[model samples]
Target chain A: MALDRKIAYINLSTGEIRKGDIPLEWRKKFIGGRGLDAYLLYTNNPPGIDAFDPENRVLISAGIVVGALASASARTHIMSKSPLTNFLGSANMGGWFAPEMRWAGFDHLVISGKAEKPVYLWIHNGEIEIRDAKNIWGENIYDTQTILRQELNDNEIQTLCIGPAGENLVRFANVMTGRKNAGGRTGMGAVLGSKNLKAVVCRGTMDIKIKYPEEALKYNEELINQIISSKVSQTMQRWGTMFIYGTTNSTGLVRTRNFQLNQLVGGSDIECENLDKVSIGLDGCFGCQVHCRHRYVIKDGPYAGTYAQGPEYTSQGAFGAEVGCNNMNTILVGNHLVNSYGLDTLETGSMMAWAMELYEKGILTDRDTDGLRLEWGDDEAVLELIKKIATREGIGDILADGPLRAAKKIGKGSETYLVHVKGMSNLHSDERPTPSLALGIATASRGSDHLRSRPAIDLYNLPVQVLEKVYRQPDGYDGPLTSGYTKYEGKPRIVLWQELCYMAVDCTGMCKYHTVFLSPNHPNFPEFAKMIYYNTGLEFTPKEIWDIANRCYTIERLFNIREGLTRKDDWLVDRYFDEPTKRGLPVAYNKKMDRKKFKAMIDEYYSLHKWDNDGVPTPELLKDLDIADLYPEESRQERKGK
Target chain B: MKIKKVMEGARDGEIRCLACFTRFRPKRGVDRAACPSCGVQWRISWPYPKTARLQGPVWETYPKPGEPIAKK
Candidate 1:
């Protein structure tokens, strides 16, 4: 079957549809999904546009590789001007929705303008219609999904819906897909709400074109087998990502009590062994073999018989350790509640943790919390707060803006307890001991995150110097590369290399956990790359792949710099600098991060990239990437002025 | 009789073995042969003083499922 590339453009004001074929050159260079979204956002100059502006477009693009013979694990990217950072923001999510979009004969859907009334888009095999969503506008995410499925009379038709939080335009509202998978950053759901779009329901039967089915099938099968055999995969398969809970806690990187402490008293309660007690079976994305996703049931609690798809390691730490709640049942129920309501677990957990700290210190009381005592380790209180946050009821209204904004509103030394870096809450990963990882967290564009860089693996497994040397070496090193598991000197370089590699994985529509580090071990990556080449006819050597990755990463950095981001914005929380763990702990918390040394490292990083002192892309560098025309003129003035 | 002999050898200096369960010990060498009962190989660097050990059960112990285990 021939695949037609259909681009769906919705005008919010007129309810008119504009359909066009994806440009041939655009598809060739950008591929699809994240790559295409990045190209489109860059071309549109969505950066610096007010996130709520009608002109600000949110494009949901599915990769060309998705719904094909290739791994259907390919994602859908939500690209928009972020209300959270007021800069370029894109968050990708994996579920049935992306494949359904492909089956609907669309490569991407570009949504622009604001609808005058609440509405939902229904696309079934190329026919599109916008229906009034007045009845389901204020529903929770679960209810909205249920109602949409009933209304469409198709339970299998995958839906992406926003909750009351999104409908209320909460700055951190996440676009929830499937049951628990979410594009959970930069408030893409709020942008959807701004357009008065309640949900996107897609169902279709069209087959995606495959260039080489036999080779693709062979490569995919081999890849799955290799994953099943890997030791890391075995561990993940057993306990999902929660397998790392005990190890991360032992490594002193688990975010605890709102990043105040590196250790938790109840850390053992949520360990892999303990999680196995509550978990029923493994859950995974469509066509995923790793099955790292998990489903857990809370058999006993104030909220009993609650089952959730995940309280994945991040959620576990955020709800369990960060808030000082040790109860597995609480974490499970909390995960179910948040996932059902379609709230970002990271934000909900971090904000609730922050609230608990304020309550503990008597900064917040029953009066502030509307008669509910917010105490640390109180699972009941935590559950109440999660519900409130979702419904924007009581204390939830205050926390809907997230920790930084909530702290500002509730200021009376409340800001001191807030543990965000650059307006985004710290993820479950703590960055106290590993300075390289700390720097990565501090410098992450979307805020404090583990995914932007993979320095955590080094902290957990390798020494610093060896990681650095390996990074300094090119894509494929033949020398005695440092064991990434051992601590050595040259770590910053390794982190930089990993960051570039991650950029490629994200753009190419591959799962990072499976593709990047394990590539060397797997026999299928080379064949997988060959499959891409066969499909797109873009022959890319591994070196060329790295170059493309570097180009994408540099462009992302340039995008931020255009919006006036500086090295000063790249910084960790004060707790990392000042707090010291009690004696006998692995965390050497009292040691102050040498700002001068970190600045020197940044200088080295800039020089290594041939960028200017202020981290702007040089004219020569842009020309080398053949993206000279893509560099905005305003950025040129900003770079020249700097 | 063979198991007893192996245990006796492990306890005596003739064996020069470390506790195989905790591999961090011995501080130097390791025995090529594993324990007959546990299949754990003892490191050679550790001095096995005959009178110094055996206060508890020899097998590895862990918390059973749903049982509350002591925190690390």
Candidate 2:
């Protein structure tokens, strides 16, 4: 019944490795993976610790349910203090890495301190070795993996590594696994780079013991059956993230031309059909039946023979709509290039769009751009810019720092063009039209990310009955469409439920797309309980699991509070609230956010979390969640005052 | 420059846009086609499925509504 997962702490400065069981209490409170990792970061890295400091620990945890003989149990949680946002640095990646780590007899790895020289950790059968990565120091992510596997004589080893972008300390650099799956947000790779660590290669032969194997198998079959049967899952399997591009584009919510416009006028033609030309096959993470990741090849184009993993909706929106490039081939190339160089595609695309805006406005020119025209939809320039940013060459150097810092450095009123929340670049979906999405991103802990708490169902325009079925409410609200701007009644409730569910999904190591994030037919609380019970042998009713997820959410809120985040910091870019999204006569046409309505919604959202007027968790609520140890009552009051 | 128009009642099939080089399906009779990316308007003969754009199919073996979900 003991999960028997252990945490390995690696001190790079002293080259020491310490292994111990993760505290059972911590597991009981935070669940596993992201929840525990967040707690560890908050406990180990104190306030004002420099993100690049040796003391800034990067915590990695295989999800509690990962390797539990369930579907898609391949998720890993990577967290550290972000060099980019300087707030909560956390990212979830799906690959074979997490299961490999678990099978290697450890559930978590807390890497700290700077290595005296470039090194990669080799983990096998609960044993750890710090091997010199001197030869592979400057290699790209793909090359590093290949060379490490060759050097270690294990082609089957799973590797989590950084590339030239990480080594050079690009602020938006990410840690990549396989050739494509990246822990792609919040500059975790830069943290790895700052420590002189290159990679963590794992191979193990140990078995992941699960309770009630028969029941688990049955439930997993049922879950997969439900998932693959759903229309949403099937569409996802076919088009990957491309299935929704048409919807986003047609709705005028997709970002275009640095958000100078909302919709791409003729974007449907490019998005609807172009991807079919390149996708060779579909791929998935560990144990997933619904393989949603696209494996693509540019069979015949200027960028021919380019094979890569994905241009997820994020990349497509960034390259296609945000930068005004309708060419899907460029997105494939950009995805491949960024993956090789270990760059966060969303941030890279945002920075590219930012520079293009500056160019179009005459603020930056060919001279500043190193003679490369930084124009919208200039596919050649976008590709070149990706390389330059990764290598930190010319304007790429300025952009390598991400938009917030890059804006300050390249100030000709450049800050005005930045589409960011809390110093991180916004996701491609323009929130000006969707109040729930706007509020979700503004209050999201990791900054401008929808994965935290997006009410995607709100965009479906489903009827009141479907909304009631999905959201568990029947009377108060009509539907998502009817509950648009100025409708605060049901929006706050949906955001709250989604935030908790999302936090729980991440903690349990499930894909958001497979959960209620996308569709009502997907798994929810009851199914989650069955999965957890069969895997960990820990019985939790749906409500109990939700409470634990709430605790995890509060702990993250405290982590941000300790770093001085407040209600004011929760505001979005002025453009969302001010500028009317100008595009076509699409649904989101001329839609501008009403700031007061947004604040009122936030006020209600804060109340839903039992937090105070300024959005700080109340001391009583912290006690109820049993996380009063995180902040004493007076300290909570002090933070609230701030 | 004004785009040249094809006369109505032309043959039905696929036609490639000479301006943008993107292949697209045209309706029967004299069809006005516009390149989605470039907005270059063109007059073309009606084209059928054979001349459809080289885009990925949306539903690639995915279960349709009312179809049983894959058991595997």
Candidate 3:
């Protein structure tokens, strides 16, 4: 009834394994998945440890509600020190792997120490074994899955693996499962590769015993009915995330040529209609009713034999519009190539787009690119460069490290075009249009991530009463497009509410698309509390959930504070605050944020969270959350050796 | 786990290989077969699945999944 789950702590260097019950105290404070992961990673790893060091830990956590009857509950969180940012790094993915791990009787798997050689972990039922991966060491994700399925003789086995990009230490490498699900941010795969770990294959058939099963089922039925009837879910189920392409382009959110332009020239060619040309059918995650993934087949274009599961709106923004490529089929190809190599699509495309801009400006040459023409919309060049980057071949060695690192290596004002925050490449969204979106990216712990706190509903231009009621602000601010009320009053509250909701949703294993991400009418805090209550029999109010989320976020803030990030780190790139969008209508173009107002907004945000003016969680607030033990004053004194 | 078809009634149709993205007309029905070009095995059958010229998996939208074959 209390959710019986164990955590597996495996030391790869010593070939040792440890198992223990999750501390109830920790569970009460940091629910599970991303929340618990942040707590464990911050506590287990000190501030100045190298991301590649043997002491750096990797954590895989199944969500608190994973494997339950709830739709899209089959999600997992991956956490480690990111090689890209050298700070607290985390990502989440949806697939069957988390459910398999849940069935295997573990909610968290903590891995430490680098193995002597390449190795893979095999978990069957409750048994864990470390096995040699000599034969599958250099394989791609798809091939590795095929081989492991054959060798294990269990086609049903679920796997989480890294590909050659990770094995080669591409700083933006991602961990992948099934054919399409990827924990694709902050370089979790590179950490796995640094530990000489190849894959974790698991199979389990045990039943998950939960409290109030009937109540959970009833909630699931209600949610399914609601999700099916919702207009946003209906659109998502049909067009996946690509449904937003036209709107994003119209609103000056479709980033092109490394954020130099926010609108694509040939819009219709990169819209969902173009994606529809290749989308053969729909595919859903483990139990997702929205079915936002599309199974695409390239039957007629230059990339006519490509097949893959997605090209989510991110792919459209990354490969299609951003690279100046008008053909959606090429975007599908780029998606397939990136997935095969287990690279982060956003980072890869951003890097390529950055390099193309440099080449176009004569900052980089053919000699620098290993004689390959680095031009915009060159699909063949894009394909070849992807391979080179994955294998770290030729000039690809520099690009493999991501745009930030590559810019430093080729520093002749190339850093001027570097579209990143805190050494991580920017997402496809153009945040300059909205202060809330811009601030969200600036303060996200993982750096330059939108999922951390993108208040997707703020873009809907909802009625002020609805906004005021949901965000609890005094008034509905003027829309994000206007630089009036949104910049002054309500943005801080919107971002704060969004971050907590997203953190809770991530921990609870619910897809944000099913929540208030797309619209104000979707599920919210009370509904989440109800779901948790029915599933785990844990009596929690919406306020308690918000408190736990605050504690989790505070832990992350403490981690980043110790790593030397300050209020100065909580700002956007100069392009957003300096240069205006190159071309668009007068109302939507030549837009730049007021840096003074942004700073004031940050102050308000910090004050609301009881954080100091410097964005540090205060001792009084930590004590209020009962987590002061995590960051005693002596820790800072000890850092100074005083 | 792989899909376990009850096999109440087998129908003849074209099927595409997810592995190789090849579409072919199987001499024996589309329930299970191998791609002629890429040699990848496929067991999932679609509802009247058709490819662009059957040369290879080009960029084209095939028919949507049938109601019975849609659920996983």
Candidate 4:
């Protein structure tokens, strides 16, 4: 029989370490990885504390099936109070780190307090040591990892660290591993930097036994075949998500020039096919068969000889469509810059695009940007802005604190031009034409993020029968439904169901690409049930798994609610209602999201979750989920002391 | 727009119909897959290895620069 991994409590101020096993009851209720991390976060803090406070914690964990032979089960979920949102800062990344963490014999680490000096954690084969890391503290992300591997004298060591962006407390800094796998949203790296922690280096050879190896192998083979058989997966393997440009840009689903247009005309220069000229090969996370990441090198022109992995579809929007630059080199160089500096590529692009919009409207003068004209298609300026934001120099310093704060600093109704939800900027897609996607980003737990609950398949024009079969079960939605991507009909039901599906997927550490992010027939609850039962001998029926996901999502809601976010926070920018999409085919063109119907949808979604119209989880719902004691004793005491 | 075909795991020869999701291998030198379910014509472009990437749900409706294609 396989044994469970323990959680380590490390206090940096006192340098005290305590270790204990996660309660089996919590595992049954919340599962592991992101779900358990969210639970721990809610119970640890009293709410409304500064994200940079020494008492704020940084929780890192491997999912329940991580390091198992299962494919794509290697997401490392990082959670902290977001300096960006000040509401539930949580992020996940795909890499080799979590599997190594699992082998190091700890499922989770709850890090607290600030260090007196810069340090890093060395965890190996069930033991941990806080070592002085002054040598690598201010290094860029790649060089920091390189230094750690060199210092440890082992190439096999995996490192998760921040760069100068994080060290400078940039609000959207990424905590990254490898060249590209980033815990990319919500500035969790800044949280680590605030504690004077540079990195966590791990090398593990501990045994992780499988309870039912033969059954697991057979089932995993079937699962892998199911994933690889999809046409979307095949496209992913070929062009990465850059293949999405073929549909999104052509159909005007993309955001161009900071939401002024739906698509960029004559921007085919940055197309995925063009990138093949520089392509070396495919790269991917541990044990993933999809191989959906591109490894490319710039071999000519301005960025000659620069090599890196990726410039995902998000990068296309960031540097290409959104900021109005149509050059591939911009993406290549911009991707390299953000990856090295540990900045979130999406947020960097959003800030640049927003600033361009401000400049276009004359709300921002040349003096505000320090005489550097913020113009569309100025690829040089976009690349320069990325560095400035990371290093907190001039205008970069203004955007480094993120859109909401930067808007307040810039004033003159800059907030109205900002595209964000819960103070975090939305992705590069213009969701004005797609109500389902709009609803997902509007109410995402981590603030305008796509990975949380995006139904990427919704715009596939999937047959109504297919949509009904996929989304209308697991608590069967009988509301009005349609196949039209632009319709506001029955979207709340679909969005709610997808929320649970993605929550469970994160809990099990499966990539959304392997699940229902694409394809109507992809794996769901019953598949997760067999996965848990076969691998860990945890017997959960499909319904039980759904209930577990419900519990996990509700806990995240409790955390954000305690942090003072209300139903109004679960809403989109006014642009969705005010401006119609200016490009794409007839189905997408001139379409604006219906405000009244959207509000009604929100009400319906809250009712479905058994919450009041305000989107907070009800007491009855919390009690039903077995997390009735939502806060800890310390939280109550903190409020009393206040 | 031209596409070069190469052998990859999922793109050996077969292409899936965007409308019906019915997958069928083409005859020698056949360049398209007409859906038997919805009677929609899908242009096949084997642009890269590992993907016989379908152009769109309705490829004929693919635009001609800053304008949606005129479609019935």
Candidate 5:
């Protein structure tokens, strides 16, 4: 079967739509979606281009595995030069959008140039149109989706749209699919808004073709069964990521009150039981049986009668623990507000926590808050401020730029309170003793995030005796009790390995949840490679997959470096280094990282990657990865020598 | 003189002398022989006591039906 390999490129200047077929060899080499998009971005690279420049292109691509016999949670990648990071930004999202795009007979959509007027792209099978969207241009995400559905007179169409936050060009604005699903990192929504594009409505009836249909069906069925029976899947199904709330809080790693404390006194109150009281049922994307998506109804509050699909683990932690507000109703309302208004929950929550701290310290007063008191537990005020942030009103106007930018604007000792690594707000997880996870966050391409590389299981499973034996420093000898959580020796190596593995998973359009289902202990790692091989007829071992992932990571790193990212950009907030948790017993407490030691570890990682000390790719490495022609020879040679 | 001879013979013979009612014939393929009058069974005189391996549930052991037997 000849699979549809067409990619649509829209030139905003002429409003000309060009449809081209991707070469068969390129498709085989790069796979599809993320890898292919990265290859395309590198080819279109222009020197000294700003992220918001008209020349900067945004490519939304669906994976080859999508819209076929793929498992649930197949993701779509939204790739562009990040307005926030000014580097190659690839944000992955899960919803019905990717499959819809595939069914429309297009592998990907490549958009460039700025539209002269407000417009939306209507993709109906092979026909494409740039329709006027002036009526819905400044609307919130919810209204835009509703209006677009009504305008098309087809409610079944999957829409990816932006809200006023994006229209106003909030640096952390997210591209929202439906009310609950968003491509929420790297400011891709801002890029869309800059193009004067309102939404992309995709609908089609084309069928996906698969190789070895019988074999693929059998493998998929077996894989689904394994996932449903896995321990982690059971926990996810039962609690929807809230199972970790109690564990994270107990372990003293749940970020609380702008990361000043690791453990919140009322953190345990946000567990599954509490959430279950308000939850209606479960929601999931197409083909997902393990519905980890939670649906909730707020019974009573200032923001009552509001229903939403989540306050997922991170969002719950962000709004509840981080702000010192343990009200489940408040978190639910916050979730609904952020989703409907189309804003990044982590960024909004982190900014609120920072503002609250500043207010308590008397650095920010009623004058700055526009008569609203910014208290630690002021749920009502926080919700209102979130609205403002979405609409860029009052204090929200200052905060819509994110904590890092907001801190720079409100300077006197406030920068210390802004917890971020890169311009992105840190996901609410303390990285005190789990230095490997912390290292992963610090070195993440997008920003301080947990999803980029999760090391929770690694930290949980490592024997305490093994850790104590590894890091035998006398000065930090707090006791055996601290061994489980402490950042001791051999952590950097673990972080580097996990990050590379996660990158591969991200590129493959596979759900990380399946990893737990298929094999808790290296669960079906080889089977996944086999599935890919059988489907694509491409011979790949597990080691080859790892190599491809490493190459992708290097390509992203090179992009960042060229965009002016340096070693200075790879460090966490000062509070994490300086402060000890006030509630915890003194066990490896007040631990600070030595810059020299961290640098040495980074150098070791670079050497392991066959890159230079400066974190650039060598010629030999790039050639091996099939990306040698992308970079100038002199730059590659310089990296090789280092 | 007869009683004294019987008693002396009973003590000497491995099977018993038939002169007294207490004396009995030795039973073949049986460990013990029964006395017809007293209803008591006694073993014939032997060099050592014959031992038999018991094949049933052990004392204080819980029994499960249909368990496989181990070959010794």
Candidate 6:
């Protein structure tokens, strides 16, 4: 079984649908899922198209091992040119939607052209239909899903939909499913909005015939057991990803009050243990064991009656700490509002916090915000802003364009207040003190993002032996690896290693929690190779997996390069370098990211990728990866009409 | 995610490192306990509000997973 899943090309303007089996060469080269998606997007999209242009294609794909008996193989990846960053717009989310899509006889979807009217795609056992979504237009995320379920009469179907934030074309708006699961960064939802497409409904009874069912079951059980055995998994199982706040906050490694502070002062209200007051237990996506998502109910407050699924550590950083709110209710309520409206919690919170800072500095006056005081921890103002941004009402309309665009419109040196990389907001976790994590976010293809390659375990100060073992992949780099979180020595190698490992993990559609994200002892290339081979009867060595990951990540880099990103764009903001951290552990306290060392680290990182100092992939490297023709001189000239 | 603070070390209770989650017995008047797993020295406030807070890591003593703990 070579996993020849079907990729569908749907044109909304002309009501035409095309389906075909993905070529085996592409499958072997790209490894399906996000890997395939990168290839599809890079090949299908011509450069210079506006993000909202009808030709800007949107792709949704599932990883190779998704339908197989695999560990946490329930992620779906979506990609298009970002309205916010205007570079490579890609987002991955954990949910059963991808698995349902696999069972519905497709692994990838290429949606092109805008519909004349609002509509949704309904895919059943081997059938695709374009259904009118006139009745559900402008519905919020929760309402849209509920309406689709009512119409389809299927409780088990999965729906990926957008809300008013997306329909209004909020630059950082996102797609949401299962209440909390969001393809949450880089404005994937706005792409759907531009197309007049509302939702993608999937339900099917098609069997996913495995090549070696018994061996796959045996190996998958072992893999699951190993995954559940990690201490990180134990903590995540109990407290969800909220547990990350424990060490990060105590160590003072978070972006507080819009990057004004290193740590949240008096922040126990948002600690992981405090979630117990609101949430009784956690939930999981399809076939996931770690269950790192919280479904909480607001116990008491104006928002007490509402319930929603997550306020992951991001929400805590977004609504709780970053906005200067020290109450759990504000975090829960804010989380609910963002999810309901299908907005990205990270970008939304970052925008709100940045605006609060601007208002505090007299940059945003009472006239701009309609006389509402943008005070810290003002629950009403915070909740009201979520509504405003989603509806594009008043000040929210300006903020909805995302920080970079909004900054371009407002010129009081306000752009300096933003804590973003490559025009996209970073996570709530401040990385000024952590060089590896800082480099990870600064160089992510989809702009400032953590999940793409954050070597989170680097903060754990694991032994250099462990670091050496982890960084020994993709290439046998016997360099000096350091476990110190603040050190720049060997950071380039670690970040590069994690990038490829993550690319492979994403290629397999496995959850990051199941891999060595938070835990150094979790699965890696060897385990992934075994998982794919045992499940699909596709023979692959760990080296092959690394090469495929390299190929995939390098192609992503190529995509961004073609979109006009240069070496200068592969760095963080001035605040990350200019302002020293005010609070944290002794090592991190009063520490600013050293520009010279970071520059050298970037140079070394480029060398590892065989990319030149300017961050261009060298011809030799491109030839080695067999992607030399991906962005040929002829294609570049053709685009320029030279 | 559990926080075990022996702040007022007034009555002896199980103390734990907020970083590595290692549970230990409160040492009499010992105001500090270094974690066996992550090796972060936590200040044990033996006051009205019992507290065991580990602020940073002692990297040299930090061990890899399943390795024997080096504790104080």
Better of 4 and 6 by TM-score: 4
How would you encode candidate 3's per-residue C-alpha lDDT over A1-642 as one tens digit per residue?
447778999999999999889887777888898999988988888567888998999999988888887768878889988899887789888879998988888889999999999999998787899999989999998999999999999899999999999999999999999878899998999999999999999898777777888888878777776665554565566677776664556445668877778777545566664556678888887777767788988776566776788878888877877788877767788888888999998988888888889999999999898799988788778778888888999878999987678888999999898888888888877777678888888888888888888887776555666776677622233433222323455687788888888888888877777677876767777888888888888777888888898889888888888877768788877788898765432334557778898898798789878998778888899999999998898865664463
Measured with C-alpha atoms, the lDDT of residue A599 in candidate 3 is 91
Residue B4 lDDT (model 1): 19
lDDT winner between candidates 2 and 5: 2
Indicate the fraction of true inter-chain contacts that candidate 4 also forms. Answer: 0.13
Clashing pairs in 4: none
Residue A44 deviation, candidate 4, in Å?
0.8
lDDT of 5 by residue, A550-641 (tens): 66777777777667676667777777667765442233234445556666656665665677656666778888887777777876565446
Note the DockQ of each predicted structure.
0.04, 0.03, 0.02, 0.16, 0.01, 0.07
Candidate 2 per-residue lDDT, tens place, A359-468, comes to: 99988988998799988888889999999999999999999998788988988899999999889999888877788888899999888898899988777655656667
Q: How many pairs collide in each candidate, listed in order?
A: 17, 6, 8, 0, 1, 8
Please, what is the TM-score per model?
A: 0.85, 0.88, 0.87, 0.92, 0.83, 0.91
Distance from true location, Cα of A89 in model 6, Å? 0.5
| lDDT assessment of candidate 5 | 0.69
Give the Cα error of residue A436 in candidate 5, in Å.
0.7
- Candidate 6 residue pairs in backbone clash: B7-B45, B7-B47, B7-B50, B7-B51, B8-B46, B8-B47, B8-B50, B9-B46
**Residues A1-642, candidate 4, lDDT per residue (tens digit)?**
454788999999999999998888888988899999888888887568999999898999988888896879988989999999999999888989999998888889999999999999999988999999999978999999999999999999889999999999999998998888989899998999999999998889887788798999888887887777677776787788888876676567888888789877667678786778888998889878888888988775677888788878889888899999989988899998999999999999999999999999999988888888889999888988898999999999999999899999999999999989998888988898888899999999999988888888888777888998888766656776678777877777788788899889888887878788877777898899998878888889888988999998988887887887778899998888999887666667888888899998788878888876667676688778877788444543553464
The reply for model 5, stretches above 4 Å from the true place, is A463-485, A516-519, A522-525, A584-596, A636-642, B1-72
For candidate 1, the per-residue lDDT at A412 reads 93
Worst 10 residues of 6 chain A by lDDT: A633-642
Model 3 Cα displacement at A441 (Å)?
0.3
Q: What range of 10 consecutive residues in model 5 chain A has the weakest lDDT sum?
A: A472-481
